[model samples]
Target: MATASMADKAKAKADTLIDEAEIASSASAGDVQAELENLRRDIAALTQTLASFGSGKIKEAGMRASEIGAEAADASVQYAENARSSFLSAEQDLEAHIRNKPLQAIAIAAGVGFLAALLSRR
Candidate 1:
């Protein structure tokens, strides 16, 4: 009787160990699958955020380029106006000098023209 009871107890213990092993393996597999799913979701979110940031930066750069172009055009117009004013002032000064010394201006002009003609023949 003692021998039979000992055998039965050993068999029961073996069965319990097998059940525990199966449960542990299934739980580990399920945990691994859940972790993988979470990783995939995080990667997808990161990709979306990066795409949005890139487009925003591109738009900002385009706006900056436009602003620079407009500033350059305004500066060009200002330079043109300054040059025109300077030319007009020079013309007025020359005209005043010529009127004040008409006889001397005519003699200087005749001499310059004679020189030009002589040089052109060479």
Candidate 2:
């Protein structure tokens, strides 16, 4: 009789363990499904928002690009004007130098030509 009681106790314990394992598996599956549903909801919301903003987003981007292009063009024009002014100033200085010292200018030119010939020989 004692042996039979022991066997019954062991069987009860095994049944309890199986029930606990099944409960745990079911709970985990339920949690996973809930998470997947939540993710789907979030993705759907984002898709809707993006669709609504499509045209407005593109127009905003285009306006920003145009502003940047205009700024760049203005900067280019200013740079060109500055370069022209600098070139004219340099020309004026050269003219003044030539007018003030014709002989010195001739001498400098001759020296430059001599140096050029010497370098070419090498």
lDDT per residue as tens, model 1, 40-94: 9999999999999999999999999999999999999999999999999999998
Backbone clashes in model 2, listed as residue pairs? none
Question: What TM-score number comes out for model 1?
Answer: 0.66
Q: Point out the worst 10-residue segment of candidate 2 by lDDT.
A: 23-32
RMSD of each: 9.0, 8.3
lDDT of 2 by residue, 17-74 (tens): 9999998877877798999999999999999999879978999999999999999999
Q: Residue 33 of model 1: what lDDT? A: 96
lDDT of each: 0.96, 0.97
Model 1 / residue 60 / CA error / Å? 1.5
Query: How many Å off is the CA of 54 in candidate 2?
Result: 3.2
